[model samples]
Target chain A: MLEVSREMLAKGTRAGLKTTWELAKVVVPTAMLVAVFKASGLLGSITDFFAPYMGLFGLSGEAAVVLFSGYLVNLYAAAGSIMALSLAPKEIAILAVMLTFAHSLLVELPISRKAGSPLGYVLIVRMGCSLGAGLLLGVILS
Target chain B: MTVLWEGFLQGLQGVWTVARVVIPLMIILEIAQGNGLLQKLNRLLARPFRAIGLGEEGAFPVVVAMVFGLTFGSGVILNHVREGKVSPEETKVIGTFMALAHALIEDTIIFMSLGAPLLLLILPRVMVAYLMAYLVNRRNQHLSLPEGHHIQGIN
Candidate 1:
């Protein structure tokens, strides 16, 4: 798979195209669900439920959706939610930190698989670290 | 179909924002990859990573991929791993770390519009991802798997 090699270059290009098309297909269906969720305002109550914990992380209720969704989907989906919602400076910064450490389960899983990763272990470790670090950072910042 | 239409419209919306920035930046980074640079950078990072149990060469691509945006850039990095340029162990470490957090550029930019400071989020995330990756890498090194599973790098 040496990208410098001609075959890799072509293969990589094709893969990139496949990725783009795949992303489009996946993102749309997901986004529609997200849109409905937003329209119904179910997220608000959920955000409210998580607000205190998130606030402990120095983020707002609205931001929980952004952080959680970003981890479940991709950054774009997270951004789409962030865009439609109103957040304070503290909230967005917290999100930035949360996202900085995690995003887009769809993309990372396949790559991990290709690399012969023990995915469950890796994910568990990463999740624990990300949440702990995010909380720590939030405490320090707060 | 409605979902498709809605998604289609949202996809269009992406063009004007995060995609515009992320796509260009990814190209710039790819074009900028250099063997000499990778070699030198890997050497410098080796000691730090050695302490964490990672082979030297795994440093830069994973770091850059994490610090940048994950979707596209990380995908590219994944492509490299598949090519055997990054070993399975290294890939695990990188994947573990980056999975925790990657794509700072797009995330920061997107959040900034909603009122967050780009630096505030970026700095903490990078440091945490690196630190956690190092620790996990160190922990794993103590328990060796079968040999010959190592992925070769370009340099």
Candidate 2:
């Protein structure tokens, strides 16, 4: 019993540290970059351009960073951008819901292919689910 | 405050929020692993797996992917495929489900830190996975694989 408890503690601490470090590494830099964009007024124009489309999802244009980064990179990148922005809870929920349906496309697409599922089908399902769910959440949450 | 400073503070605050949630959650997950709770959960998944058209053989990798994440889940699927324990059609179903929703616990908490609704994350993802997998399986039921079709693109 004692040995089991000790092992659980050791495993937990190790996993916790690893997760924390990975999250911190991504969050810090992305947060800084977002700040820089805001200060330079770059974010404003970017937001303006995307506002119409993003508004469909009930998110600010700034949320494009989170969604696109999540698709092209990974969840950590998306999470970094998400954390940097000061969004309302509803906006965050919408973005989060969309991302859950689709994120890390480049990496995961091939995995699906290797698993013998057609890549095109995988893309359709992911992208379809993401946008469809996003639109739904936008309407319901907004 | 300068936007940069504000960004930094926000970053720190976000990190703090994530840390508070992630650290303890990770610990509990690890303990769950140690205590065999994850395996039990995997076993408990059989009913849902059946509802989604995945056989008993399909449940392990699906549960692994949900609990652990993509790479681990796919790796397990590949292993079982090689071992001849799971069929390609079933693997396709598993792959579809995993694509829709993997890494449930960790991903949920991370997003929750940013104030996303917890139910929105888990419930929809699960429903989508279940629906998609069942559809994929039903659609492909009549299609037979070519003889000796090895797992493709897995090198």
Candidate 3:
């Protein structure tokens, strides 16, 4: 009984730390990038280019910032960007789905590549899925 | 004095709100991993993945990573890779698929909060992504891998 209890406690502590680590990846980047990107106005330029293309997938170009940024940062950063901007309901949903399949290629790639799977194919699949899902939904609803 | 205090209060409130949501999610995902339930599920799903020449046991990591954020969900996969249970080749493939998509839970919630149609948006989103990744990974595996390379990073 004592052994079981001790094991459970140790497990709980590890879980807590792991979760904290995951949350921090999101929260920290969001806190830092909020002001920087907002002030830089670069988000607008990137969105303008991606806007028409993203609209092909049922989203606004401006919303592309969240999707594109999702790859460099994590969902928290994407969420932060979403909060900063005023996205249409449909646009927000589409962007959300697009990011779901692909986020933070940089951070994840090294670890994944180290794991030794096909890097290029994964990118293609996610991008294809993102575009397909995004546009199909965009057309039907929006 | 009043404005400064007000600002401080709002900041504190914001932090607290974020903390509330993030903390619970982290804990739940952690338990999901710690209990070894994930591995059992992965082995079950591995069969379908194997039909395409990918490992069936990958199902667990892919599902978790899809539902949770990669940071939150990839621990089990990482543990396996380190233990040499998964070949490095499989890891790269899984990593790529995951990079393109993971953290389905938090993601759909964000969309829900943003006023997207959860049923229409979230459901098809996962199905399509998973399908695509599986197909692409399978098709691409026909290529000849370099010879004389021993798999690395296992214990």
By DockQ, who's the top model here?
A: 2
Compared with the true structure, what per-residue lDDT tens digits does model 1 show for residues A16-53?
44534544554454556566666677876887899888
Interface RMSD of 1: 6.2
Cand. 1 Cα-lDDT: 0.61
TM-score of each: 0.65, 0.90, 0.67
The 0-to-1 C-alpha lDDT of every candidate, in the order given, reads 0.61, 0.83, 0.61
Residues B25-110 of candidate 3: C-alpha lDDT, one tens digit per residue:
65565566556756776776677667534566555567677665576446868777777777655665566556655766666655
lDDT of 2 by residue, B17-111 (tens): 87887777877887777778877887788887887678778888889889988878889898999999888778888999988889998888878
Backbone clashes in each candidate structure, one number apiece? Answer: 8, 0, 19
CAPRI quality of model 2: medium
If ranked by TM-score, best first, what sequence of candidates would result? 2, 3, 1
Best by TM-score: 2
- Highest-scoring model, lDDT: 2
Question: Which regions of candidate 3 fall more than 4 Å away from where they truly are?
Answer: A1-51, B1-18, B30-35, B43-47, B54-97, B106-122, B136-155
